[model samples]
Target: MRIGITLTDSRGPDALTRLRDELADAAANGMQSAWLSNIFGLDALTALAVAGSQVPGIEVGTAVVPTFPRHPVTLAQQALTTALAVSGRLTLGIGLSHRIVIEDMLGYSFDRPLRHLSDYLDALLPLLDGEPVDVRRETVRAVAGLTTPRVGRVPVLVAALGPKMLRLAGARVDGTVLWMTGVSTVRDHVMPTLQTAASEAGRPPARVVAMLPVAVTDDTEAARERAAREFEVYGTLPSYRAMLDREGVTGPADIALIGDEKSVRARIEEFGDAGVTDFVAAAFSGPDAARTRALLGELATAA
Candidate 1:
């Protein structure tokens, strides 16, 4: 599997600089890709555009940019622009987010997310391919075309977990970018459902990019405790909770790759064995951060 790392979640005045250095270091270390999340702080696509402009060796992507807030046309435009800025190396990962965040926080309904994704892709894909779009589905409508130069076709991946979402992703887009999901879940549920749909649709094999917290340490219990504390919110989220249940794990910490170097390396290999195309490590080892990074770099080089 191709190995990658997430950008540091550093905020404030030096966040951009820190991310730029991280990207450069990853490329220099032979990492295949670097992923950025679109959460609260800086916009992920814009940040990647700026940071990625200087480092053109490794691929850059968003773990996800939510589709609710931005129109399909607008997002296509932005993604294309960012792709151009980054030397045609942008994989646009998008998702429905969650009902709590969409309704309570953003004041947008999260109803019928599968249908929304289908409609959103219908509009967004064509625009990204430099074609005219005139689709008007129930959840999305785009009747415009972009004049931007083609920076190759921007590959799209959806953050999918449930069956419907996976089927839609396999049929409509390139693949799925997963988080809080384990190897067993990917092997039993994700691969079967996604690959079948892609095959039925006459598409090529789907890509599965798995993102999980990783730590390299001998103190297993301490690392597990730290992961439990740092990533508690994911255990409560319904979609992630469902995957945790499917993996037959109690919480987020159970799926995390935490242990000594050998154990952690073995766990990472398990994901590749289960058909993961790429493994993006979200290292959260605190004091062991540098050690964890060194391991990831070594693994990336080996991969």
Candidate 2:
């Protein structure tokens, strides 16, 4: 399985510089890819364009950019430009962000999200492939094509959790990128649902990129407590809550990979054995942060 690390910005004065340093460090440590989340902080695509230009040899991607905020045409344009800037190393991950963020925060209607994604991709995919887009669907409409110089088509991954989303992802996109999901869910529910949809669609086997908080430490209880506190909100989100339930786990803490190096390594191997295509580690070992990264780097090199 391909191994990578999720890199986040601190939102500090030198956030861009720090991001560049982090990318370089990840590459130097032999990581195959580095990913950033598109939250309320820095624009992930733009940050990667600037910082990733300075760092070579490691692939960079967005864990996800919410599809609600940007029109498909505009996103296609930006993603294409970013892909060029990053030397065709950009994997664009997108999703229909939760109702709370879409409706409550962004004041956009979150009804019929599945339809929105279907419509959004209808326009977005053609544009990314350097073709003219004239799609007009209920949730999205685009009539134009991009003028940006062609880089290779960007690989798109959807942050899909439920069966419907998984089917949509498998039928439409390259693969699915998962968070707050466990090995059991990946082995039984995710792999079956996603692969079956892809097979029915006559597509290649879908990639499963599993991401979770990881910690290599002796204080397992403390790590669990920290994970519970830091990632508590995910357990409350309905989508993530469903994944937790499907995994037969109570909360995010229960799904976290936390223990000494040996235990943590064993759990990660379980993900690979369960058919994960890529394993992205969100290291949160606090004082043992360096140690955790070292282990990830070692594993990545070995892979």
Candidate 3:
């Protein structure tokens, strides 16, 4: 399996520099990919452009950027620009963000999310595929000029969870990015649904990219505490809650891979056995930045 690291979207003064250094370190440590999560912070594509130039070898991807805030045409243009700047190393992961964030926070109606996503993909896919897109639907309508340069084969992944979203990912996207989902969930719930859909469509099996919090430490309690604190918000999110529950976890502490090297390695291999094509580790705890870097390096090599 391809292994990677995830940069947290923490909005602190040192976040950007830390992300850059992390990407450089990840590339140096032989990681195949480096992913950035877009929650409520800096633009992911812009960060990718910067990190891409600095780290020449590692693939740069967004675990996801929400589709509700921007039009599909605009996103396609932005993604293409980032892909060009990165020399075709960009993976554009887009999604319909949660209703609470879209409707409650952004004040946009969350009704008909699947339809909106379908319409958005219908227009966005062609634009990314180097075709002129003139699309009209109930939610999104766009007419694109044929003047823009095309970045060939910019892979688009989707943050799909439910049946409809998984079907859409199978039908239209290169892969699915999953968070907080355990190996069993992937084996029993996600993989079967998505793989069946892709098989039915006569397409290759969709890549299953699993993102999990990882901490390598003999100090299990401290590591779990750090993971719990960092991942607390996800536990409360309605979509994630059910997944967590099924894994017998109430919070991030319960789900995170926290233990000594042997235990962590075993946890990671479990995902591989569950048919995960890619593993993105979000390291959450250590003695310091140096220790965290060291652990990441070890995991990269071992992975």
Candidate 4:
């Protein structure tokens, strides 16, 4: 399994400046990859490009960039530029963001998202493969191709939850990127469905990138309470709520990896056993931030 660390959350004008330093720290400690989350602050792809150049020997990627706003043509250009900056180390993780963000926030109609995703792949894949995308689809339009001598195919993983999206990821893209999904959901729902679809399409096995909250702390209850406060928004999101229910979990704290060192390490191993190919650790509050980071560094190697 591949082990990656989520760059510690930073939201400020200095966030971009801090990203490279964070990635440098992760790579120095033992992480193989560093993932950046897209938010109102730093642009994830841009941050990865900057971080990747400075932090050698560590893979850098966006946990996801939303697909609704950027056209496939522009998205392809941006992804290629970022990969070029990193010497082909960028794995583009794209997604159809929640309706709250898409229609409610951005004011884009969220009509037939599954269809939009299908149309998106049809246009985006060809561009990544260095072929001219001359077709127009219902949700995307493109008439361009990358001229930046294809160093190698930049892997694409879609953030998916439902069956149709998982199948779509398997059939077209390299794999799926997940957040707040549990072991049971991955084992019984995600893996089987994705594998079957890729197999039927005669494609190689698909990748499963799972991201989870992790905290290395002796005060389990206190850590859980802190986690409950920090990541409460996810519990209310419909897609995340469905997955949590499937895991028999009451809240995000239930899936969080919080315990003494040994127990925390064991929980990470459980994810590997459940068929997660890549584990992204979102380290939360602990007694000592430095100690927590040190523990995550150890788990990252085993991850």
- In the range 223-274, model 1's lDDT, one tens digit per residue, is 8999999999999999999999999999999999998788889999999999
Q: State the lDDT of candidate 2 residue by residue for 1-303, as single tens digits.
A: 999999986688999999999999999999999999998999999999988899988889899999999999999999999899988999999998799999999999998999999999999999999999899789898999788886787999999999999999999999999999999999999999999999999999998899999999888898899999999999999999999999999999999999888999999999999999999999764788887898999899999
Candidate 3, 119-211: lDDT as tens digits: 999899898888888899989998984445666788989998888888989887887999999888888888988988888888898998899
TM values, all candidates: 0.98, 0.98, 0.94, 0.96
What tens digits encode model 4's per-residue C-alpha lDDT throughout 96-185? 888999999999989889999999888888888888888787777777776755668889999989999999998988899899988889
> How far out, in Å, is residue 160 in model 3?
1.1
- Using alpha carbons, what is the TM-score of model 2? 0.98
For model 2, the run of ten residues with the poorest summed lDDT: 283-292
Q: Residue 117 deviation, candidate 4, in Å?
A: 0.7
lDDT of each: 0.92, 0.92, 0.84, 0.85
Alpha carbon RMSD to native, model 1: 0.9
The residue-level lDDT of candidate 3 at 195 comes to: 89
Angstrom error of the Cα, residue 257, model 2: value is 0.3
Q: How close is candidate 1 to the true structure, as a TM-score?
A: 0.98
Q: For model 3, how big is the CA root-mean-square deviation?
A: 1.9
